[model samples]
Target: MRHDASRRRFLTIALVTAATAPIALRAASAEAAAPAALPKLPATDAAAKALAYTENAAAVKHAAFKAGSSCTNCNFFKGAKGQAYGPCTLFPKNTVAAKGWCSAWAKKL
Candidate 1:
């Protein structure tokens, strides 16, 4: 009787844990499988040409960051360190820089 009781108790716990394990795995996988977002910049290579700059770095192919700036200090930027590109009221998509820049620019005070 004692052996049977122990076995039953262990089985109950195992079943419960097994059922919950999938839920936990799904949550973890959702986070792990998520792709890291790209950093946004003030302007793309083409967009930079429209801006007024005596030295449009992107225009001359001398841009400091054609596509590598972070979101901490971009014109359309709206975030802090480690955060993905925050939504830009200026642009259609949520984008910012991670060490990037262009001609069409403005420093958010």
Candidate 2:
């Protein structure tokens, strides 16, 4: 009877360890794969500005930030080819156009 109890306890511990082993490994892998630094945005030269979305009147200005373009048309928009963010001369520091807006929008020039 004592042997049976010992075996049951061992099995319980082993089962718990087995279940948690995968979880621990997964967490380690995820942390390892995590980016070392903040992800970068695309370049903003003349070529990047070609995809700007501010020309569309329907596009709204970025909230909170009074100077940058909105995500819809900003040069850094991350949507589809047309829907993605484009480059803007306004926000030189921020790669994603998800920030501010301005009237200086050019037609890719």
Candidate 3:
């Protein structure tokens, strides 16, 4: 009886661990998959300068700049609607102002 009780306890522990292991791993992976916060891009940044980036689209001096073109409508923009700033594919690890404009801007489909 004693040996049977110990075996049952061990089997119970093993089953519980097996059942929960995947759940625990999934939780850990979800945390790891979370995106790190991106920093706002500065207008004076070298990349920004090369792209003629302006925080305000209306202030852009590039000849190709459209009157209504802005980061919020750009293909590269990854920010949520109404946000002040968000990530851009052109400037990894940095975010652009929603109202900003750059030479690399492509109309979002």
Model 2 lDDT per residue over 56-80, tens place: 3345443433333355544434334
For TM-score, the strongest prediction is 3
Model 3 TM-score is: 0.75
Q: Residue 73 error for model 2, in Å? A: 8.9
What C-alpha lDDT values do all the predictions have?
0.53, 0.49, 0.93
How many residue pairs clash in all the candidates, one count each? 10, 15, 0
Clashing pairs in 3: none
Model 2 regions lying over 4 Å from their true place = 39-43, 53-69, 72-95, 100-109
Rank list by TM-score: 3, 2, 1
Q: Of the pair 2 and 3, which is ahead by lDDT?
A: 3
Error of 1 at 34 (Å): 2.5
Error of 2 at 45 (Å): 3.7
Higher-TM-score candidate of 1 and 2? 2
